[model samples]
Target chain A: MSLLRKGQQWGTFACVWHIFDATWQDPFRSAHLIKKYLMGLYKPIYHPLNQCGDHVIVINSKEIALRGDQWQKRVYFHHTGYHGGATWTLAWELHSKDPTMIMKKAIYSAMDGTLQRRFTMQRLHIFPDDNVPKEILENVSNQIKQLRPVPNRLHEIPQEERDKIPRLIQYPSDYQLK
Target chain B: MAALYRVLNYLGKNVVLTAQNRNISLSAVTRIKEIIQKKEGNTLTFEAVIKPDPYEGRFLKPKNGACAICSSGLDIKHTDVLILSQFVTSEGNILPRRITGLCETQQKRISSLILMAQYAGLMLRRSPKGGLLHPLQKRKWKKFNSYYDEKTIKARYK
Candidate 1:
């Protein structure tokens, strides 16, 4: 029941601008959760084309949550064209080697081929520690500026976002059709 | 009629060249002449301008470097603005024609140029920072990893 509650809460997450240092959760699992939250797949108004997602930064990657006897049972395998060059490593070993890589790979996998997916994956700035650089926070808005929250039908802007000058859209001049 | 069409076409291209760069649209003029020839039962005499395009003199200066975008514009003035404006994005997508406001003719040329740059590895193919994820990530709960789905599995297995 507790697990279900946490999962439910995670499903409707608002954009939290904080560092992820809560626990030693498996970044692999946490990355998927992060991807789901930021990709709009879990949102009420999820549209495949609509730009809807939040910027997520996972800091202190060295510590993330994990479950099961995955450290032993889980083995990552990769191949090299040369025979007998196949490489394998356990999750426990990889986590220590580079915790940042694990989450980076997982979140990357979740995003897939969407423009928003690209934005989400790209927006995910990871650091080994809890402190985010000042430059990153400043540049966040420019990163996700293209993805519109809602489709502009009349191309009207709400009172808040009207400060940015958008290209004026107009109906064809009366002389055009004639 | 064919001659008149060629004359009018050359006149038009020359006018554009005169104002901008030395790009005389030699190909366009050739195309117009060819088009006129293709017309059956042609009644007009054809005339090709033997004189050099006037725009070339203003835009292209052998003593002074010519503007790549406009040969006719003095000192190739607009090249810097044009080149900077057309810089490719990190992900390989060439900026599209609409926002750039380039005419169809110039747009086509720019597209070809961008493609060459990308192919030569001088430019990146505007791709997202992280690559696409295979479908198996979402479907991991199902215990099978795959790029294909049920429809594909059914087709292949059957």
Candidate 2:
């Protein structure tokens, strides 16, 4: 095979490392996206029995955003295989106890239940913050686009830009300035 | 009858005397007189001239007298702090409908969006004065990033 064909073959089979930044992203929605990559469904040769899945490195998992009071509303249930061992934890409480747990569980539940599920999960990595190990960081070759644009805080905006934005309302005459 | 007539006459005289006392002021004081006085010398005087707003004509007024927000037809989200901040006072209260010129539905929607933005920490800078901290500096659940769905807003702005 020519050098070009050889390189193409290697690329198709290579377990590429993909990085996803979870800051301001909804974990549940992003789980489906991340699952696609982890399962290597993006590959043309993807098959249920194929060992073609890639590794996904999720960073800033602690900064994940949940929609509309889900932090206090959503509950995670756990059982210890014994009588009266059931426990339920709110989303925010679980996050506080383990920042990466929510993101991990989100992606874990997003995939189908199969014998390969455990092995597939082994390929996924999550970090509470952006402080990934240098060895793992160096292996990452692709960045997964964020599901939504990270909203900017008002205070983070520069004063000049704030002034340049067009005014929508003008105070009427005789209006006292607050 | 004689004593009642005497009491009535005494009350009438006292009322006239009090009215005379109340009228002893040099002149009536008003906001317009105060502003004119400050502009001129120490002597207060009334001026009927219309005061021009510094931001007059800076914004695009709605055609046919429609509300500014209604005419624009912008789907504003909570994260749109720049647009949201325009509807709020410097002290962080929503401007009244009379001044905002927004319709009832739009006013309600904007106020709700402002509240959501404030709670989500998107409008932290515009929050009321009192040692307000950044989102990262806030306590436990609040310190973590959170976002709200505009659909969850109780006020429907259709």
Candidate 3:
């Protein structure tokens, strides 16, 4: 094979590392996108039996946002294999116990329940904050886009930018100013 | 003759007495003013000056008879704090339709969006302090981040 063709083959098969920011992102929705990278579904030569999956490192797992009242309404079930050992934990309670547990469980449940599921999960790394190990951080070459843009708080905006927005309504001449 | 002489003496002094009629009410007065007190020589003068509008000619106006929000055709979400803040008072209360000039449906929609933004903690500065806890300090699940879907708002106009 030509040298250029050999280089392209090596590039196609090489496993890459991707980074994702979970700040204000919906974990369930993000799981679907992360699953694609974890299983290497984007690869042109991907196969069910092939080991072409890439590694995904998620940062700010604690900041993952849920839609509506999911934090209070969603429940996580646990069983200790004993009589009356089954327990239900609310999403917020689970998050308080371990910040990364919700994010980890989200990605784990997103994939199919196969024998390789556990093995595939080993390639996923989740951090509660941005403090990733140097060795792992060195390998990340790409970043996965967030599902939704993070909203800005009104108090956090600077005074100059706040002054620039056009006024939509003018108070009546006789209206009292609060 | 003595009573006429007393009246002539009072008129000769050139003193003018004026009684200004004012209505007293429990509600706040709409006329906002800045009171300025000036002392010159031996006389003190008090003046109530009307405050000027900061956004005089720059107000967003719709060309047609439609409301500004409807005419602009901007798909406003709860995250758009800049636009949403315009429809609220300094205390974060939604302005009345008479002052906002928004249609009934648009008024209802904007109010709902403001509520969602408050729950999400995007417009905490404008929120009124009624409860014991501060608006910035949320408890339990309320502290966490949450978003809303605009379609979930039930502002149906028949």
Candidate 4:
């Protein structure tokens, strides 16, 4: 495997490609992580406009998880440039309408505005699902892991396996655990 | 014969001409159109002029050059149409080249620019539309807004 600096920049001239998979992860947190990488914060030679950022590919955005009541509290507003064209939609509604919007917005907002900011943003790629085209996928040199692992669902645990666990304590005769 | 002569005298010049041209059979008023044209000559009407086509049976070809932004020398990053809106749909998928009407090179450029914008939080990736609520989510905030008489939420954050 080549070193980060060598692989990212070909003799200090070319940009590197960095692909990521974000399936079943919180979009807010993942976006933050992506923004850091985008600015080359991790590199010692990081600068504002040297074009040091690597290309990032994100997949399975549809499975993004939102913590707590953010879905209800968050709202996006827009206008149609006409009389009474103002519209407001809840976070969840927008997610259903476009699965990849949140992550893209989060990443876009996190980066600082600079001369290279626009060029940097173009390196980021996001998909709602894992249906990326083969031509694009071929350029992926590495994968950025999710910040947190998604917890397994209750249904995913088999009934026979659940029954095998030992009981910690017995309930009182008059008290009902149910 | 005497009655016919009286009728001809009443009809005057037209009758006299008809009688003179009896061998030719019908009067000018009731004569066949072809016979009338043959007699009057075909000089009254103009013939259709046939001109050569400029395009030679071919339609105007579509431009297969660089996209509007690239051709105009305006960077894709500065253009919201390519970065924040036009290139991507509300559902967060990249619009196809056919719909965007961009040439292959420009389409590729815009696609990269969009990804860059997304990475920088200049454009949205995930849907702004949130998921379904459990009816109890953010209940306190909702009630607080109602009690405070804050009906319009426009420009609240701005």
On lDDT, the leading prediction is 3
Error of model 4, residue B71, in angstroms: 72
> Which residue segments of model 4 deviate by more than 4 Å?
A1-14, A173-178, B1-158
Best candidate per TM-score, number? 3
Candidate closer to the true structure by TM-score (higher is better), 2 or 3: 3
How good is the docking of model 4, by CAPRI class?
incorrect
Candidate 4 chain A weakest ten by summed lDDT: A169-178
Model 2 has fnat of 0.58
- Fraction of native contacts under 8 Å reproduced by each candidate: 0.00, 0.58, 0.71, 0.00
TM-score, B chain alone, candidates in order: 0.29, 0.61, 0.65, 0.35
DockQ per model, Cα = 0.04, 0.35, 0.38, 0.00
Query: How good is model 3 by TM-score?
Result: 0.84
The deviation in Å at residue B119 for candidate 1 is: 55
Flag the better candidate by DockQ, 2 or 3.
3
List model 1 lDDT by residue over A112-175, tens digit each. Answer: 7755666667656787667778866654432221111111211133534433322211111111
Candidate 3 residues lying further than 4 Å off, grouped into runs, are: A1-8, B1-49, B125-135, B156-158
Candidate 1 stretches greater than 4 Å from native = A1-19, A42-45, A110-119, A138-178, B1-158
Runs in model 2 lying further than 4 Å from the true structure: A1-8, B1-54, B125-137
Prediction 3 global C-alpha lDDT: 0.85
TM-scores for candidates 1 onward, in order: 0.33, 0.80, 0.84, 0.47
Better of 1 and 3 by lDDT: 3
Task: Select the stronger candidate by TM-score from 1 and 4.
Answer: 4
